[model samples]
Target chain A: MSAPARSTGVWTAAAGSAAAEPRETASAPPRRRSARRRRRWTGLAFAALPLAVYAVVVLAPLVQSIQYSFFKWDGVSAATWVGFDNYVTFVTDPILRSTFGHVLVLICFFALLPIVLGLFSAALLTRAKQPGMAVYRWIFFLPQVMTTVVIALVFKRIYAPDGPLNQALRAIGLDSLARTWLGDFTWALPALGLIGTWVTFGFCMVLFISGTSAIAPELYEAARMDGAGPFREFFAVTLPGLRGQLAVALTLTMTAALRTFDLVWITTHGGPGTSTLTPAVALYKAAFQNPQVGLAAAIGVVMAVLCLVVALVITRVSERD
Target chain B: MATTVAVVAGLALTMSACAPGGGGGSESSAQPSSISTDIASAGTVTLKMTDFWGSAEGKWIDQAIADFQKKYPNVTIDRTSEDWGQLNSTLNLQLQDDAGPDIASANNGWQSLGTLAKGGLVVNLDSYAKAYGWDSKVPTTIIRQNKFTTDLKTMGSGSWFATPMARTSLIGLYYNADKLKKLGIEPPKTLDELEVDAAKAKTAGEIPFQYGSLDGSTSALLGVQAVLADKNKLNDYVYDVPTVKASDVGMKEAVETVKKWADAGYFPKDFAGIDYQTAVANFVKGQGVFRWEYTGSLGLSTEQQKHFGYVQLPQSGGKTVGVGAAPGAMVISAKSKHPEVAAAFLDYLMSPAAGQTAVDLGLVPALSPDVKVPETSLSLTGESAAAKTLDSDDGYVPYFDWSSPTMLDTLGQNLQLVFAGKMDSGKFTAAVDADRDAFLAGQA
Candidate 1:
């Protein structure tokens, strides 16, 4: 191939070698230059549309919220300039800080637990390449495919006072342990967190499955010959090989944990005495329900910054490894 | 800063383009101030209306609208519906956008009617009240409950902005008739008797109170407030009179009652986790013997309605005296094209035909003293029970959370802590007092 590519374009055509590389410089210079310039201009024009749309739809709201954070507005009347008063309130307010604490707890359920569960699932599946594996994948992936609203509705019924959960507890002779899961301050937040875990574990599982599949079969075989067990092979081969996938999973799930709204909104609306009071729910209630748009915007800005920083830290750590 | 202004200005321009405003909202529509007492001659105007009426309320309002259209043949009516809790918030946004119904109903509050009035999105009905003699139409006690300042921050003394159609709501004890009869217990007439009844019901393995306080605990709090606070002091707090303090009517007993009820296993094992509808539905399904709910929420079918009996949340070891209530306020959009016609529509809702319709559907309608309401099934059950409280020398008190702008959140989020013994009464009261004081300070 290198010998053929050393020939000029006309000589290559005469040689009739199908593998001969064509030289772009062989084209007429003036026409090619003008056409290339035109293509570049047209490419920019097309890309310009989405970029503009991104700026308007995404960045514009962000900038507007940041601006709103610096004022006192009730979402209707004229905004009063307040400098950093709203942010100061957001950070200092005990209620708001507890909301952040709830978000951190959800991170364990939504990100940490899911990642660990996903790794176990991937390890089991890859070790054996079990029969009907696609079915297993689909079953694992079902939660991710279902809409959050529908999941919330289903879970609401499941967590009802007379729901199957308490009924099951009764059947198992654990009646003393049964209580309203979502309404109890201690249980409500964890119950909400467990739902986050249910929703995200499948997503992590699928990521790890794909990550483990791409591992070299020889690595496993070599590990087996060298006396490495299933768990050992996982750490030495499967886990290390999936660094990129782990980073991706951590980033997606952690960001989801940080900015959770719909689930919390639909489930408890940050209730049972602020036990489930997530920052996202706080922002929404502040803006819409409470009509404190400025404070809501300030909370929103802080949440966005927190998510970005955490995501960056995770990605940086994973890349280092 | 410039960018923010530009975006906001663009948004404002878009809103005004969508909905007509009465000269940027500060003034009412420039249309004729002349109005009529008679609905027949109200002109050939089609009125647009919006409210967060439930299906039952909507059904009766439809009856009212049909009767109205018959009286005013030339007028057409267009209506939009929204969720009860969401309507006011959405209306504020829609009004800001200059795009909503000619007349709207919002629950009276700093969040709802107050926002509308302060935003200059509604008509000041002072002229219409005199023109149509509505001053004589509605009783002052009921009418004053809906009044707000021109600034919309304070209530009790300002020009009236809206007319309340159905204002009489009382938090009453809803007991399962079958369960009570089988258990051979009469509806309790006093607070201690209620606990005795609850204890009996609990022994039958039934949840005594179908109380779920997830959203804000106001439902359960309503029952507790009825148990604790005096009617006059409750009114003073709700009306924002400066002399009253929450500490004066301490909720220590109220908190203890709730905690005791939970510990006694009188409530559902998972009561805190349940939502409003589930609790109500479970009660209706015979899973619970008693429920503490608003007067209007008892929209039981005639057959289903037979299985229930109503009594006020027993207060002060006497005949039930007070229940929480706030009049539902309906206001005309100042930007509406036919302000007179819309105002006339509001007037028609107060007519005999409409009042009868509201009565037939089992709601307490606010109307002239002479309009006779038939003693239907609802009247015998819910309305009669509510009357026992209201007609007692003391009238209904406003909801406890209605005391401040952030009081709902304060009660809603914190009350859960109190019930779960996560926070005691002192901490809960302190948090609530801080919110109320901050709101009052802001008002001043």
Candidate 2:
């Protein structure tokens, strides 16, 4: 096999040598052809590894999932072709309909809240000369590094009837406010959403901080020169510059919201009359807990399609301006 | 760069060559010579066992595995136990791909085993049971739960799918004995007496009963017991009937009885949201007169066991009944290479001595005659004595959550709705009927 650098050297040298040897054009053509061939083979070898990995890890499972959605299978049994029956069932299932609603609420928690909070924090940090700004950053970023299981468990204890949250409420003489956070149907979903917001805002804040740092100080200075206040300069310069990072953050956080399972499973397991059940949790219950793999696959397929569409829209909109 | 790529490629090839065939292959190949000479000669065997227990419970399993390893020095055990939240999907995914651990701790319910049996994923163990002398020792009812047909088409028809590891009788009603004494109630015997005592307890500013429909198991436990306490209804609904129709008069009566209890505030107001552990905690804290739980819950730590009384749930309308079941079972994987060695391991695990270990860990023994269970483990002391008497009277019935192949989740969820007052009695019954009908029809 030709060494990559050696082949590149041969090609560049041949081109340079051909330019000098104007009289031997016919001989130079054959030598150039061999160099081009070597380069082509080298390029193919480099691309093949990643392509194969992608096919195995991503594309293959995705295709199989789509195919499996059409079958009635309990994962182990003989799969019977049910056409679109599983999908139809998913569309009709009241629980799944409610789950989608929960997923939407989770989007607000995982995406909207984080983005808004991240922006506010970034704006504050960019101007403040606080002594413990670095400490604050570290504290805020702690949740991002903490395992979801630990977070879920800590939250579960806090949400329990006699937990510190309730104790604090009672300590302040707000007796009526001290109720089981995860028990009441009206409160459970919003409570779970609140945890999601808390766990994810750190990630968004970090992303925003990095994105804000990348914005040129010259642009901010120019905005200020144009008589722009901090907010105005932020809108004109900082926000526009961080558009790419925002797109990335929103996509990742939105996906996390849609596919939430650990926190819900650990905390509520879709309890309090299925009030906090998201699509991912419902799919897991259908597949493993209920052994309805066909239904689960159908849910997965639908979720994938929905996520793809939403992500596309979000990406397009984020890129537009 | 070319030299680097070539070196990496060489390393990759070497690694791939040593990658080991799948995962369980090498492990099964390395069984002890006493178990299998070929396995011993092949290399060290390492078997993986998965369970849904963490921390203290996980330590017990690890200790059991270590004990097994001491008896077979050549064989190594790889234990992978996680909490339920993690285990749920991991187990399912592994089992589906035929990449599951050689031994798995599985629930004994039909809903859990039915699909696996149908898929031919679990091994048939009739021959193993006979060779190991397990057939005569394990109770027929307990053994029956693990058996499947030769074709692995249905559970309880072929061979043992899992070995019974634990036994628990759903016999006890946890109550505050001090509170009951204060209310002048001597463990109510009849439904009428129970209601009167409950009212008295409530009047004395105590909760009559504390049960949470949150986890859904409580619904099945209380509902099945209600059906069992009425002999005529049990016969009509469970035995005499050819098919379970929702419109059956006995079922209707049972539903109504439960609803009545709910309406009278016999259960805690937030019962729909409290988990099993919380319900137990509340009972221990003197918040309620009675909380229904399995006999095994009595083995809770001393602090958790304070001042609790165990009594049988009172029979309604002159009949007494309760719910009980053999504990979870272990099944060999059909994909296992050394099925014989796996069978021997299960045999050793179910022996009287090994069975006693489980009993010592607060589970009842499946082999009743040979194993001696401790008095504290067996006794229904304090408030549990009356309940134990009622349970021992041959009126006790097995819980019906395992009655069918796929009704557990449906029943649990629907019951949650019922407890939450989101579904009326008629609607709940209809929903249950529809779910049962659908499941049965699918089986047919």
Interface RMSD of each: 5.6, 8.2
How do the residues B247-363 of candidate 2 rate in per-residue lDDT, one tens digit apiece?
Answer: 553445555666677778887876655666777667666788876666656455544444455555555444555554444567777666667656666666666566456545644
Which 10 consecutive residues of model 2 chain B have the lowest summed lDDT? B20-29
User: Candidates' TM-scores?
Assistant: 0.86, 0.73
The best candidate in terms of lDDT:
1
Total clashing pairs for each candidate: 5, 11
Every model's DockQ: 0.30, 0.18
Candidate 1 per-residue C-alpha lDDT over A1-321 given as tens digits, one digit per residue, 9 for 90 to 100: 011111122232322432457566755668578888898899999999898986776666766676677667666655666767888898898888888788789899999999999999888887776789999889889999999889988887788777888899999999888888887777888888898899999989999999888889999999999999888988999989988788777777777787787787888878877778887778877877776877888887787767667656765677683
Lowest lDDT 10-residue stretch of candidate 1 chain A = A1-10
lDDT of each: 0.72, 0.64
Question: TM-score for the first chain of model 1?
Answer: 0.87
